[model samples]
Structure formats: C-alpha cells, structure tokens
Target: MLPFTYALRNLFRDPSRLAQTVGGAALVVLLMVSAAALNHGMTQVLSASGSPNNVIIMGAGSEESIERSEVHLEAEAAAATGIDNTATILGTPAVSGEITYQAPIRTESGKEEPALLRGVLPKALLVHTTVRLLEGTFPNSGEVMVGKLAHRKLGIPENEIAVGKTLYFGNVAHKISGTFSAPGTVLESEIWFDRNDLSTLTQRDTLSAIYARLDNPEDFDNAHVFTLLRNDLELSALREDDYYSKLESFYAPIKIMIWLTVSLVAAGAIFGGLNTLYAAFGSRTREMATLQSIGYTRKALLVSLLQESLLATMSGTLIALLIASLFLEGITVPFSVGTFTLTLSPSVLITGLTTGLLLGTLGALPPAIRTLAPKLNKALRS
Candidate 1:
C-alpha cells in the first residue's frame, strides 16, 4: 500500500483543482448548516413560547390567529369565576385579558416598522410565567414596555429603544417604560402596553384573548368544559402549547422551501465537484498504473484517492464552521409573528460533518474506480 504521505502530497498536485474541490464542499456544507440552524431556531422559539399549564380563550373560529380574535371584555372575569383548578397567587386568580395588535410605529428617530403589540394588565405576568423584567418599571398610562429583543424585530439598534426613549402611535407618543425578556420564546419580540391605554388607542372595546393559568396540565379539560358550557360567551378554549404547535405547522411550508432550496443548490455543487474529481483522476491514470506495476494493489490506489478527497472536504468543513461562528451565530431573524436567533447547536454541527464525509467518500468513488479499471499494461502505455 502507498504511504499516507503519498495521498497528502497528491492533493497539492493541481492548485486549481484543489481549490475547486474545497470551495465546492464548503459551499454545500455551509448551505446545509444554515438551513438546519434556521429551521431549528424557528421551531424552538415557537415551541418554547407556550406553556402547557396555560390556556387561551378566544372567539370561536379565531383559534388560528390571536390578533384576529375578539372576546367580550367580561370574558376575563367569567373565566376567572367559572374555571376550576386555576393557579392563584394570594387569592387572585391568574387570568389576564389581552389585546394583540400589529402595526407600524415610529421610533424616536422617526423610523417606522411593523411591530407586534400586546395590551395587558399587570396580571399578564402571572400567566406568562417566563417573562422577567430586565430593567425599569412596568408600563402605566401613556407608557409601554419593550422586549429585550424587540429592536431586532423592529429593524433598529437596541439603544434606540432603551427605557426613556419614545415611540409614536399615530399622533400620540408613549414613553419606553422598561425592558423585559422571555428567553427562548416569541414574547421577546413584542412591545407590551397597559390594557386600557391600548384599548383607547386602537379604539377597540373587546379583548383579543383571555389567558388563564391552570394548576396542572390535566386541568385543561376543566377550562375546555367551561367554554363548552358557556353558550352565551361564544368562547373556544385551547391549550397554549397546542396553539403554538399549530403555528409551527403553519410555518411548515417555509421550512420545506428552505430544504428545497438547499437541495437544489447542493445538487449543483455536488455535480460540479464530481466532474472536477473525474477530470483530476482521469489525468492520473498512467501514474496509478505505474504504481500498480510496482506492486501497489488497485484497492490501495482507491483508498489513497479517497483519502485525498476526504482531506480536502474536511478542510472545507472547517472553513464553513469558522464562517458560521463569525457570521451566522446569534443572528436575529424576524418573521410575521416574532424573531428567533440562529445558533450552531449540536445537531447542526453533526449534520455538517456528515455531509462533508458523504461528499468526500461517495463523490470520489466512481472516478477513483474508473481510473484504476484499465489493464496495467494498457494504462501504462496510454
């Protein structure tokens, strides 16, 4: 068998071919890594945003979108009174009536972009247990609280929306009261307002939804039963986690499109790399035949060729990882509902490594075998 150094030395034989193989592998791996990270981040944020112990009560036929849902303002009091096994703190039922609105609002810089706005009472903190105030006080009349990552969704710098800054809604300006964070959840991309303030500003008398926190997951049935029994309320009850799961399904098409795009682009890169390998191996046929005459087996030659290919592809994988760490990590991406940050999790890293191995081994096979196929004398004389 040829020494391993023989494989290593052959990789540098043609500088252009080496660069092509490495660059192609890098592009393919990078695309796949990015797609995996994007899908994972989006799915995680949606899933983490909801809690199994919480239930959302919305108007009938509006289960798909909270922003479109409308319920009587009295529903909050009714649910608090009717639902059993609800979580309570100091004898106060953990129920919050909220209004959700999406509209473009101007920052202090006069920049306008669409923002997800939620109107809630202080009791909102009871039901959305993940939320924690990062700085300043909660909003009062003419004041609003911003999420820690709200600036990402608004396409502005964080300092632009710091506490004490101002946001304009129509002709009125609201002070930035504080910043809050709900880690790993979509709530981190919203701006929250006092329920009454939002109702007056949006000119809506109804609540968009009622949030109730139950003592346990099994207590969801009690809330569901309450909704069914109250025919006059026209309310539909759904578990918070289930609602977000439906949202995840709603975004399934986007995830599919991402994979489709990666597949098409990676197909082109794979074919291009294969062609480069074929040409490079074809030109080395005589050299392989001479090695065989020196008692090196065809199998040994094939292994050496694969070793060379793996080295190039693995180098490309390292380059891709470096680029992702520098540019892709912690990138905040905003969508219709919220924003998510891209991360190179363990699963994404494993996927990239596997892709590089497959490209190097399977992509090099046909060319390596073909180059060694000729009779030893025939190949040497060619």
Candidate 2:
C-alpha cells in the first residue's frame, strides 16, 4: 500500500495544477453554499413568520391570498365567539380586522416600486406579538408606518422612506410617521395604516382577513369547527402556523429554480474539473505504473488519487466558508412579500462540506481508472 505521505508529497509536484484543482473546487463549493443559504433564508422566513397560538380567518374562497379575501366587519365579531381559551388584553379579545393591498409607491427619490400595504387596527399589534413600534408612533389617517425592511423590499436607498418622509401611493400622499420591526418574521417588509383609512382610500368596505390569538394552540380545532358551523360569516379558519406552512409550499417553485441553477452550473464545473483531472493524471501514467511495479496495489493508487482530490476540494470548501461568511452571512434579501437575512448556520456549512466531498469523490474516479487501465508495458512506454 502507498504510504499516506506519498500522496501528500505528490500534490506539490505541480503547484499550478494543484492550485487549479483547489480553485475550481472552491468556486463550486461557493455556489453550493450560496444556494443553500438562499434556501435556508427563505425557509426560515416562512416558518418563523407565523405563530402557533394565532389563527387567521379569511373569506372562504380566498384562502390562498389575503388580498383577495373579503369579510364584512361583522365577521370579525362572529369569528371571535365560541372559541375557548382566547387570549385577551384589557378585557378585549386579542382580535384584529385587517386589509391588504399591493401597489407601486414612489419613494422620496422618485423611484417607483411595488410595496405590500397592510391596514390594521390597533389590536393587530397585540395579536401579532412579533410586531413592535421601533420609532415615532403608529400611523393615523393619511399616514403610514413603514416596516424595518420596507426600503429593501422597495429596492430603494436605505432610509429613503425614513420617518417624516412623504411617499405617493396612487393619487394620495401619505406620511411615514414611524417604523416597526418584526424580527425573524415576514412582517418586517409591510407598510401599516389604519384599517378604516385604507378601506376608504381603496374603496373597500370589507376586510381582507381577521386575526385572533388563542390561549392555547390546541384550541385551533375549535376555531376551525366554529368557522365551519358559521355559514353566515362565509369565512374559513386556519391556524397561523398551518398558513405559513402553506406559504412554504407556495414558494416550492422558487426553491426548485434555485436548485436548477446550481445543478446546471455544478454540472459544468464537474465536467470541467474532470477534463483537468484527465490531463493531470494521464500525464502521470508512467509514474503510477512505476509505483505499481514497486509493490503498490491498484487500490492503493486509486485511494491515493482520491485522497489528493479530497484535500484540494476540502481546501476550497474552507475558502467558500470564509467567502460566505464575509459576504452572504446576515445579508438581507427582499422578496415580493418580505425580506429574510441569509444565514450561515451549521446546516448550511454542512451542506457545503458534503457537496465538496462528493465533487472530489466523483471527479477523481474517471481519471484514476483511466490511469490504471493500460498494461504495465504500455504505460511504461507512454
């Protein structure tokens, strides 16, 4: 068997080739890490956006989109009844009727971009525990409170919609009276206004949805039953967690697209690296034949080739980790509905490492086999 040191020393025989292998592996692993981070960031945002203890009631036919749902104001009161263990504050059940709209708004810089507009009563803050006022005050009539990541979602310069700035939506102008944040949740990219004001502005007499907090998440079954029994309200009840889970499913296509891109690029990298390996190892055929003549087995030579390949790929993996940390870690990516911070969590790191090892194993096999296929006399002559 070839000594471990034998393989280690061979890596430095051609420093330029060694560098190419390592650099290629690094670029491939970097793409893997970036793709994994994007998936993690989006999944985390969807999973964390909903609270288990909250329930949403929307019009029966519009379960997929809150903006399309419409319930008479009386539906809020109807849905609030018959649910046990409901959360309450100051003797009022933590319930809110809300409306949602998506429209293009002109920022202070006069750049127009689509923004999600949510109109909620004061009680929404109590029901949605993730939200909190970060500065100034809640919005009043003719005013709006921007979410912390609203500018990112709008693709505008940071602080361009800061407090006291005016933004034009449709024909009406609204003041940015405050900013709010809902950490680790999708609510951080919405603009909030008084529900009545938004309804009047948009000519909407019905609410898009109703939110309620329950004392125990288990009571969601009762809430669902209540919605089924009340044909009068024409509403359907769904647990907030279940709703967000559906959102994850809804974003499944985006995830597939990301994977498709990575797969296509990684395939190119693997084939490119394989060609390089063929050239590199093909040139060393005589040396490998000489080692075999010196009592080294074919398995030993194959293992040595794989070891060198893994070493280069692992070095590239390390470089990818550093780059992901420096650039992708904590970077905020905005989507149509919200923004999420790219995370370099342990899971993402593990994914990158696994991809690197797989590349090394697969990339080294063809060349290693080709090098050993020729008879000893033929290899020596070559």
Best-fitting candidate, scored by lDDT: 1
Candidate closest to the true structure, highest TM-score: 1
Candidate 2 at 72: error in angstroms?
0.6
Q: What is the per-residue lDDT of model 2 for residues 1-382, given as tens digits with 9 covering 90 to 100?
A: 6778887888898998888888888888999899999999999999999999999899998888888899889888876666667798988888888999988988767889988999987888879899889998999888999999998898887678899999888778899999999998889999998788889878989999999899999889877887888888888988888888998999999999998999899889888889989999999999999988898888999999999889888988899899899988988998877899998989999999998999889889999999998999899899
Q: List TM-scores for all candidates, in order.
A: 0.98, 0.96
Off by over 4 Å in 2: 1-5
Mind sharing the TM-score for model 2?
0.96
**RMSD (CA, Å), each prediction:** 0.9, 1.6
Q: How much does candidate 1 score in TM-score?
A: 0.98
Candidate 1 C-alpha lDDT tens digits along 156-238: 99999999999998889999999999999999999999999999999999999999999999989999999999989999999
